[model samples]
Target: MSGDRGAVELEGVTKRFGSMVAVDSVNLSVKPGEFLSLLGPSGCGKTTTLRMLAGFEQPDSGFIRISGEYVQGVPPYKRDVNTVFQHYALFPHMTVAENVAYGLRQKGVPKSEIAAKVAEALDMVQMSKLAERKPRQMSGGQQQRVAVARALVNRPSVLLLDEPLGALDRKLREEMQIELKLLQSRLGITFIFVTHDQEEAMSMSDRIAIMLDGHIEQLGEPETVYEHPSSAFVAGFIGRNNFWQGVATEHGIRADDGTEFVASRPEEDVPNGQPALAAVRPECINLSAERPADSNNVTAGVVAGVSHFGDVLQYVVSVKDRDLLVLTPRAHAARFQQDDNVFCHWSADDVYLFSARQADIVMTDGDEEIHDN
Candidate 1:
């Protein structure tokens, strides 16, 4: 640690297991006190990358620096970093305070100092009231808070989290997300969080590195990644979109479904007449019973489903053997129903076009992780 609060850098980092390349040529930098996230599907090497940072696993190639200091072979304990895993590995027999104080005692800190730090850490996480309770006596969320306190008790420059909220239910997980983000902001600690959950990463991180098989596909802020995807895979994974297989044309692309799309914002350059793909987000689409006379971007479909999400209404419309997802604000009058004929339309500015190079890859919203390797 270079006396700086927090900073991390990876240069050409690559990790391999036998014949498999877990991570390939990864390069990233995190500012001091920044909250960064490694987000991707399982087997995309996010956990492996975090493990390398924690010193639990070593990289075959590249450099890693913590607070401007190269930590090639420094042990986990010696490095200026702490890890909080999904499972709260607290001692079942020890009280919360005891569990937090164990690290300080192992380092031979004075009993007086350990007591003060333990109290401070527990209070920081709002768990001071449960200091006397054992892990078995606490709720799942409470135990998780204790685990976080235990990690913070060490006061490491950087904190690495691996799906710390994975085991919690939806409501609890969301609540903890807000709490943990606030905690990191208050402490001004550099947090390197690893998660396969897109919404979690989008909600918490200052910047997100979206990974794919052995490599990073894109890196940007949440809004940037969501609004302007760099590739077809990114457009599909960052959120939901209606995709069209097509061939690039002079203005935009001609869809396989016979819908011609003209994107005012084509992110990728493709040769005219070449294979291509176009995508439009559900919120960008409008549904009407009357078909537009214009041919810019319009399609006829039958509403297959309607779902209310409090603030928004989502509809699945089937058109020409393919289903398109559309979202409308709840403030708008609900005008469509299941099996009703509808026309969907979007402006050219709302369309995004991508090269067909990534058309063959199947993107599944990061619901599965490749843990076998």
Candidate 2:
């Protein structure tokens, strides 16, 4: 792939399947050599957008350009990009080396040079020792590495991955995440990764484009999105949060449970007395056995549940018939038992206030556990 590549541009991109619009009028610009992730829940059009970029699907009413060249009607084989899907898709009969060399052979590359390129690609993914193994003989992670090698073997300027780590176990997935990130940095190639996994997107991407209902919801660095979410959906989707439904008050918001909150840095402006939703991250909340003094953000609750997650402790505090989740470091964990009285307090700076206009899109605790699909 050429190192001197230009930006990838999508202008008014839209795609539809029957009555449903898979992708809306979306516009995006990806910097050269940038790692950008398309993140959202299932049916949010993340995969469709990536397919459009890979030349597997065409936009109904938009234009796409790769490396400064318009690629209308271009076939996947001809596009200057490669796609790696969740499934390995490798031929069961073919060895890893043969699978990695398939594209070169199909394109009629000189046999003299094919082996060298295959070796280079396999080495890039650290799969040289398994080059002779078939897909069925290797673990999911190994097969995934070979699949990635096959894509990289083509030397495309851009790589599009659709939840490439979704098939692995937690530990293996995390290991591959680190490996893929390091590989991308070494190559400096443009990577447009599509995943529903928030942690995956946050850890591997330079910037994340959170999509919702076929449209781009928010685009920014992971920290920016997590600290200052643009909408209730963005705040709820990017990380764990406790939400309160209420009406906007003069200073903050009045919850349906009769608790009021003040957000020192509200991302959006809402008229006074209007309905709104407030969110705060679990780690931002401080839990204690004693009531906090002189704080409007403090609420009385009882410990409903406790979960230990290695280095962190998660608490479910029941306040006013609502179960609010709170996270604390294991070292700083408060010894509160189920049914024990507790106090939850947070600073105004840690609160996120959003207009109730997005309540329908924002997820709640009752919603299915949000994961990258």
Clashes of 2: 2
Candidate 1 TM-score, C-alpha based: 0.96
Q: Candidate 2 — which residues are off by over 4 angstroms? A: 1-6, 364-373
lDDT of 1 by residue, 1-373 (tens): 4565588999999999999999999999899999999888778998899999999999999999998889999999998999999998999999999999999999999998999999999998999999999999988999999999999998998999999999999999999999999999999999999888889999999999999997989999999999888998888788877788889998898988787888888989878999888888899999988888777898899999999899989999999977888999989875788999999999999999998777766363666211100
lDDT of 2 by residue, 252-308 (tens): 889888888988777789788888888889999999988889577999998999999
The clash count for each model shown is 3, 2
Report lDDT per candidate. Answer: 0.89, 0.90
Give the range of the ten consecutive residues with the poorest summed lDDT in model 1. Answer: 364-373
Q: Alpha carbon lDDT of residue 107, candidate 2?
A: 99
**C-alpha RMSD for every candidate:** 2.8, 2.6
Predict model 2's lDDT versus the native: 0.90
lDDT of 1 at 130: 92
